[model samples]
Structure formats: structure tokens, C-alpha cells
Target: MTDDIRVLVIDDDFRVAGLHRDAVASVPGFTPLEAVHTLDAARQALRAHQPDLLLVDAYLPDGDGIRFVADTERDAFVLSAATDAVTVRRAINAGALAYLAKPFDAVALVDRLRRYARMRNLLGGDAALTQERIDRALSIMAGGAEPATVSRSATEQLILDGLGDDDEASAAEVAERVGISRATAQRHLAALATRGQVEVRLRYGTTGRPEHRYVRVGKR
Candidate 1:
């Protein structure tokens, strides 16, 4: 086990992967090995790099992120736009040290990574478990005591700003564009969908089923 934690990011979106790579690199005592777009590439990178941490996307073009965790014996985290309870539980079962719904703030991500680093350092043959330490770790990874403070008005503006030239976008796409967590983006999008401000549709792909996609309503 290396003292300097190495990270590998697995995400299909080049931009999102880049953002995460930068986020990890900006943290002290952490180094990013590489960011890959598919599970196959991720596995190959793991074989070659033997990374200390894996930041995996929930959905990938080649396979599910859970499969990667099952196949690898390394510490991992699930970074995804899907925050459904089922997905969260699956990630936990898959042995992820943490589950971060995208688009997580840079600071928030750094905080989680720092906690992981601390945990790794503190682990020893006789390290005793204490409630305080456990609580602190959980709090750090779960965004601490601060509730998500993004305003509905700000969310609407973010959605609008993320609109593409084609006038439509998926919830995940918009979340990435707006730099807010996917869960937050979906909440705002749900409100817009209900009010006829945006249209919601199923996005079918190779990820096993169709996912909800949101677009500005009445766009030409």
C-alpha cells in the first residue's frame, strides 16, 4: 500500500472525467493515474497502474460500474448521476468505499478523498474502532452537516444555461454543464417537468434500460 494514493477515473464523458481528474489532482497527497471511458480500458489501466483508488461511473458504454468493483479487489467509489436507492445499495454491495452522486462539487469531492486518505493512514493491525471516528468519516463523505443550499431559482438558471444549441439535454448532461450534483439537477428538472417548463423522456442506450432525459419544453 502506497502512502501516496493514486486514482483512476472511469467515465464516458470526456469533460466530466477531466473535471474529476483535475479535482483529484488538486488535492494534496493524491495523484491521478488516468481517466478512461470504458470498463475494459479501466481494467487495463488497473492492471498496469495498480491504482489505490477507483472513481467509477455508474453507467459506462462497455459495462456497469458494479462489475468493475466486483472484478477488482481495490478500494473504489461510485460516481454517478443515478442516485436511486437501488443503485446506492448496489454500489455499497459492490464494495465501494463511498458513493458520490454526480455532479459533485470539487471541494466536496476533495473532502471525501481526504477522509479516505486519513482512513487509509490510520488503518493498522491494532487500530481500534471508535464511534467518533466513524461518525466523522461518514459525515465527511456525506457532505457533513450542511444541507444542499442550491436555490430553486438558481437551479432553473443552471438548467437554462446548460441548454445546448439543439435546445434539449439529459438530466445528467445538464448536471455536468451546470456543475451541481445529479440528484439536485434531477429535483429541479422534475419540478420543471411537472410545470411544462421542460420535457422529460426516456433515453435508451446500452446501459441495460432507458434513463430519464430532460429538455426545455417547446424548444424548436
Candidate 2:
């Protein structure tokens, strides 16, 4: 049998689901199955495809995505815009291997997938396990890393300054406030999040996908 890891992408947003499907397909030794939207579709896909890993979001039309992951008892990780402490804790409690916030760059996702693959191989190997091997595998699963510290450029600083103390704004709002394009604002915000200079939070509306908003660290 093939050793490729099968991944199922579940998101309410069609475009975001497609983006994740492409991301999963880009990784070596990983196969992307059909991208599904609602929780009902996800359930059908799970029963039909039995994917090895799930790339799921928190908000869905039918129900909570993380709870679905818990109920299925599958090997999965959350790729979502839900950054609230309660949501994060619930995912962890429900046995999600990782909870990646939205707006992450493609490189970050690739690296996480690679590390997960490595961890999977180590755990699935037939060889006898040792302390060192087990420790290494667990470390990969933990995925702990110190936040990066980097110098900001002029444009980045302008974007940062646009936000008032204790205020949160989406990339578009930041862009308008800073007189830059939304794409430029998003890029700088992602960089700032990586550098631990800002925090990205998700705000769900009455309908549609959640909005990713950024705030200065220690402000929230």
C-alpha cells in the first residue's frame, strides 16, 4: 500500500478550502482529497475517504469543526481563524495535534506538514523505540518555537502605528488607515505576527467566514 498521507480540507469558505487543498497537494508524501465545506459534507467525506489527516477550520454551517475532529478520533490539526483562548484550549483538549491560526504564509504550513510527516514516520516505524527517538518525535509534535524578533521597515512601521492602543483592525482597515494597499497591509501584518509584534485574532460574523484582525501584542 502507498504511504502517502491523505488529507481532507474542510472550510466554509470555498476559496480558503481550495487554497488549503492546494497547499496539501504541494507537500511531498501527502495527497489532497476533495475539499468540503459544511460539517455534513465533512462527515460524508470522512466516511467515504477516511483521510489520514484533517485540515479543518473551527466555524462551519452545521457545527463546531474542532468538536467534529474530537468525535471522529482522527489524526488531525486545525487550520483556522479561531484564535480565542477557549477555542484553542478546546482543540487541545479534543486532541488536535496543532492549531494554526489563519493568515499564515504558505511556507509555515509546509514546514508544519513536513514536521508532522516526520513525526508520523517515527511513530509508525517498526524498529524498537528508545528514549531519544521518542523524545524527538514528541518534540516535533509539540512544535514549540520562540517568536521571531526582527526590525521593521518604514511601511511596516506605518501600518503598526495606524492601530490605536487596545484597538483591533483587519488588514483592509489597516491599509485604509495607513494609505497602503490591502495586500501590502496583509503582508506586513503576517510578518508582524511572526515577529511577535502583533497578535492576529478571529472575529466571526452572523454569517460568512471569520475576519482576521490584528492588534498590538499586550494590547488585548
Candidate 3:
């Protein structure tokens, strides 16, 4: 892995900031910087560290954290107890990569961090972006709602069933196993992957080309 993605957490609550910092450090690819309790301190840390990402709360002692994200124009995601529509809209318009409501479980925060890591993994090159690549990155950033919140079709369920635990197979292989066309298999796999129900790994062969292989990840 390359240098860990450095993170700065900003919140007015000292305990919450510490919790968030610890959580960020627990993730595989992330390194949490010292957490800041005010937008003023956050600004100083930003200048000093220029971290790859920021985890910001909506309210800060000095100013609005979402506004701070906008002012910094850095890669930021919001974790706040603020549930107002206007605040959400501000986050959306401010270009927050993702947002999580406060009082969330550790698993939920871990899921978001992992999803962000996956997006960075996918779009990690300087080459020109293709539509497919852009779409895949966007899907990942969307951080699909949990399975219980998303209704799945019968075919999608069948596709999920085709991949056994510890199995990683290409869409074409899954198509063959599920008696579906490769295109259909690819489409459904992409959807499942976006929803965090499956993980995508790139298999490089002797030909030097990479093939995407999917592994079951989330619940049924």
C-alpha cells in the first residue's frame, strides 16, 4: 500500500473528536491526524498537514464545519448530529463526499471509510477517465443504502447465490454458473458491488490485462 490516507477530524466535542480519530486510525488505509475542536484549529492543521481527507462535524466552536469544508475545498465527509434538510443540502452543495448522521455505530463508520478507500483505489491513476470508470467511482461514493433498505430482484438474488463464501469469480463465470448472459451478469454484479454486498478484485493475467472478479461481502 502507498502512504496511508491522512485524515483530520473536526468537532466541537472533545470526546467525539477523540472517538472519531481513533476510529479513523483503526481503518486499514487511513491515518488520523490530531483531532481539532474548532474550525480555527482545523484551518491550522489543514495548512500544516494538508491531509488527504477531512471528517468534519456540522457544528464547530468557531464556525459551521460544512462551511469550513467549502472554504477549504478539500476532500471532506460530514459526520454530524444535525438532521436538518438545510444542513444536508449545504453538505450536498458543498460537495461533501459522504455524510453520516451522528450516533451511528462503529460498523457504519467503518463501512463509509472502506467505501471511500475503494473509490480511491478505483480512480487512482492519471490516465484520462472513461465513462465506465467515472460511473464505477460514483457508484462507490454513493455508498448504497443497506440491503434491508434496498429491494433486490430475483435475478440479483440468484447472482448473489452464485458466489459461494471464499469464492471470487468474474461476471462471465458467474453468468455461466447462473445460466445468464455475461452482460446481464456484469450489470447485476456492478450493482451489487456498488451496494457493498460484493467486493471487486482485479485479476491480472500473463496477458497483462486485468479482469474484475467479484466476491460476496455483505448480507443477503
Candidate 4:
């Protein structure tokens, strides 16, 4: 790649930052700029290196990574151990591109990094994106670029965004959220399940037949 994406890995833990640096380096179109431990160091490095992206942790000794990232205006994704909804919401509100809870396999992080690269390329083009281009690019971001046979339509993208790989939601719930028919939501969810993009399980209740709930598979 002519223009490799420069990345800085920022975390309070030295070992974790180094591991993330390696993961960022492993991707084809990404370059590891440097890994820093604290928010102060991250700021100095950011000013010095001006990396295109940041692999950030939410907790920093000097300051909050969410505020730092939001202030920086650079592309960022969080690799954090904080699993609370509040933290997740703050990260999202801070404009994090994506968030992964910690203690996860490095492979999962690499997958998201690669997906983000694809996303950057698609949306970062100088020319304005057409409607179809926007839809397809977002679809690829959600479902990934693999399994070329399985296509993700705009409706399916809505389902995936609502279903979010971290939690389980019933078809009706997803339908209501995305404003789609329950049957349509269920069909898309089933398609995603067949692709190993989601997990389907039976949710047993007090006095009814088991209801099928779909959960995203890669949140560990």
C-alpha cells in the first residue's frame, strides 16, 4: 500500500500497549508508530508523530482517553477492559469508531483493525460518496469483507447495527428498533447466523415456548 495508515497504541499498561502495537503492525496496510503508556505521553506522541489512527484505552493516568480522542479529531477505536454500559456510551459519544471490551484474543482486534482500514479507504476518498457507495461501505464494515457470497443490504446493515455483536436481541426487538418487519429482521438475523456473524440461542421463559434470541458472536 502506498499510503499506509499510521497508528499509535495508547494504554496505561506497558505490556498491553506493546501487544496492541504488534497487532496493529500485523495488519497489511497499517504501520505501528509507537506505543505509549499514559495520556501525557500519548499527547506528546500525538503532536510529534501525528498518526492517522489511535488504538486507545479508556483509562489513562493523566486523563480520560475518551476526551482525548474526541479532542484529537483523528480516527480512533477503543481496546479497553471497561465493560460497563456507561463507559461504552461515553466512548461512543466521544466519537470512537469502534469499541472492544478487553481480555479478548488478539485475532479479534486484528479483524476489527483490518475492517477499519477498509472503512477508512471507502469513506476517506476525496470524491464524495454516492448513496450506493455509502450503503455498501457501511455493510462491509459491519459484516466484514469476507464470505463474498453473503451480501448485506442496507436493511441488513440496520439489523446488524441494532443487533451489535455484544448483546442478544429478539427479532421483534430488532424490528422495532430498526423499523423493519419482524419476519424481515429474523430473516436477516438468520442469514447473519448462517455466516457465523451471530449466534442464535433459545431463550426460555416462564410459560411460553422458547423464543429465539440472536447475539453477536465476537464480543469476548
Candidate 5:
């Protein structure tokens, strides 16, 4: 599994930032480091943590976020309620990878984050890169991208879809969800773990054999 993209949530509203952090954790390839409410704290966090992504808001109690986004070198995405054309243009001009309006769906945000991860993987993971592959990855980030589909059996896809939240699941739980026998589900999940699409860890009991829990591949 790839390293989870560490995220810093910068928003004035504590509740909103907490929600965003939870949303980030629910995504496969993202993990929230911390949430800060003011520009000073954000700057201190940026220096201390050096996160891979910044989910920033346009309004801050200490300072405006427009200049901050424009000047920051890290990858930034704007999630703000400010829907004015000027704010939108400024966010784009400030090099935001994605500008999600307020009240957006968490699923939609996860999709975009997956796209961003795909692009980064294409550029950083591939040893032999090509123009076509680069274009395809960039297209994904540009929102005209194809779905990140894989060739697998229908049952396998169903299991993968069921793990979208990327939470750890036991074989019995997966069997219930996929309408399969526990043995079959465990077999499939173990195979996926071998293929690096899932991760398996043992949970010890007080007085029995350890139980295996599986999670979708990511930094957990």
C-alpha cells in the first residue's frame, strides 16, 4: 500500500474541519494530520508537519486565505462556501487542484482525492513513464478522467466497492455484505491482500486463536 497522504484541514469552523478530517479518513489514500482554525496556527502546522495536502478555507480569523493559497508551495484544495465568481477565479488562480463548494457530498470529495492520488502515483510510482500515461493521469485530475476501473470478477468488484470507506472488516462481515460464504470471502480477501490491494492484521483474543481483520490498502 502507498503512504497515506497526510492532510491539514484549515477552516475557521471547528465542526466543519472535524467533518472534513473524518471525510479524509474515510477515503482510502488520505489521512488527516490535524485541523487548525487560524492562519497563524496553519503556518505553524505547515512548518511542523509539512503535510502532503492542505484542505483550506477562504476565510480565516487571522488573515485572508487567498494570499496564503497563492503563496504556499504545497498542494492545496479549497472547500469554501464563497461561491462568488471572484472567489472562484481567485482560488483557481491560486493553484487549487480542486475547489469544492460548501455542502458538497463526501463521496464526491473522495472521488476527487482518488483522482489526485492516481495522478501522483502515475508520476511518482512509475519507473518508465510515457507521454500517454502522463496525459491520462492529468486528465483524471482535470475532471474529464475515466473511472479508475480494474479488470476483476463481479464478486471481487462488489467486495471492493463495499470497502469504499476502507474500514477494517472481518471475513464474516464481508460474507454477510457480499452474500457469500465466510470461507469464500476470506479466500478472496486473502488473495487481495497478497496482491497488495488489501491489508490483513491479526486481532488477538483473550483465550482463542487470533482473528484476522482486513482493510483496503492504505496507510491505516
Candidate 6:
């Protein structure tokens, strides 16, 4: 990749397109070249700007986003809420580098984009396509490991890291530090508990039934 990697955001929802555009702009070595809400507009933008990367939605007003990826020269990734396995497989078949679910945090977007930038840089200008290169790209897209070895999401990782120092933290406290909801914090905590990473204790309150508090298993 060059010093500045240009990205085009294509989504039917203008708000979502803007969000993705802003996310790409916030990443280092990246520039948001255009935000288009339809496949037709995306094609026009692609012809005009020739971006280094394309972030396209699975659903578009004009046509299937996968078609755009199939026809475009730029590296593409799908950002959508659609979880159907068939759709995801089609996207992979269409040459999307990554398939990110919707409502992902900006940090996750940056991570994916940075990975793509690294892959592009490694290939260099005029680099020949090889089996090794294809394997590396697939590995990156598959989260760099087999399913069993893959780590948790960024939000989950943050929660785990935060729990590293403190043996215990309330859901409210975790939410405040992680910038998520208390319910979301609790759900993650429960998942960690299930995995034996932490232990939970119920603290009874005078005015209510009880509240759950979590503590790292080995820490305390």
C-alpha cells in the first residue's frame, strides 16, 4: 500500500455509509475517497477515483454489492448485518477480503483496514499473484487462525484486559470503563465466567434482590 490508502464506502443507508467513511478516515495511512449509497454510484466512484479499498454493504438499492466487487479492481470487504451463511459464502466467492457484521466499533474497522493495508503493502506494486499470497490473504480474512484458536472480539478483549489487573469488577464499572451498556457488560462477564476465566458472586442489596459481581479466577 502507498502512504495514503484511499477507501470508498458503499451502502444504501447514507448514515451507515457516512459512518464507515468516517471510520476509514480515522485510521492511519487511509483516506475516505467517496461514500456512495448505491451500486451504480459505487461503480461511477470506482471509475473516477480508483480507490485502494472498497467497503460495500451486502444490500444496495441498485443491485447486489457482491456484483460490484466481482467487477471492480479494488480490494473489497462487506459490511452488513446479514448473517446468512450463504450470503457470506457468496461474498467470499466474489473476492471480498473481509465480512464485518454491522454495529461494529470503529476500532474493529481500523484493525481490519490495517490488516488489508499490510497485505497490500506486502504484495507491493506489480507483485505477481501466488499461492502463498492467496493463503496469507485467506488467513488474515479468517482471523489468522483456525476456528478453535481464534481469540475473542475487540470488545471482549478489552473486558478481559481490564479484568487482568482487578480480580473483580461490577458490571456497571466494566460498562463505564469499556463504554458499553451494563447489560452488555454483564453478558460478557457471564461468558467469561462460563469459560472459567472469572468467578461471580451475588451481592444482596437492601432495596433489591441481589447483584452479580465478577472477579478474575486466579487474581483473587
List lDDT for all candidates, in order. Answer: 0.75, 0.79, 0.79, 0.78, 0.77, 0.75
Q: List the residue pairs that clash in candidate 2.
A: none
What shift in Å separates residue 153 of candidate 6 from its native position after superposition? 32
- Residue by residue across 18-115, what tens digits does model 2's lDDT show? 88888888987799999999889988998898899998898898899989989999988898887899999999998888889998887777777877
Error of 6 at 203 (Å): 54
In model 2, the worst 10-residue window by lDDT is: 143-152
- Candidate 2 local lDDT, residue 35: 95
- Candidate 3: where are CA atoms >4 Å away? 145-220
By summed lDDT, the worst window of 10 consecutive residues in model 3 runs over 143-152
Q: List the candidates' TM-scores in order.
A: 0.58, 0.63, 0.66, 0.64, 0.64, 0.60
Question: Stretches of candidate 5 above 4 Å error?
Answer: 125-129, 146-220
**Reference-based lDDT, residue 134, model 3:** 55
- RMSD value for candidate 2: 17.4
Question: Residue 157 deviation, candidate 1, in Å?
Answer: 51
Supply the TM-score for candidate 5. 0.64
RMSD of 6: 12.2
* Prediction-by-prediction clash tally: 3, 0, 0, 0, 0, 1
lDDT per residue for candidate 1 within 1-220, as digits (tens), equals 2366899999999999999999999987799987999998998898898998999998999889887886797889889999899999999988898888887798878877876764554242365744543443354445454124535675575576456335567776665445455787888889877888888787689879788877676665
Residue-level error in angstroms, candidate 5, position 208:
24
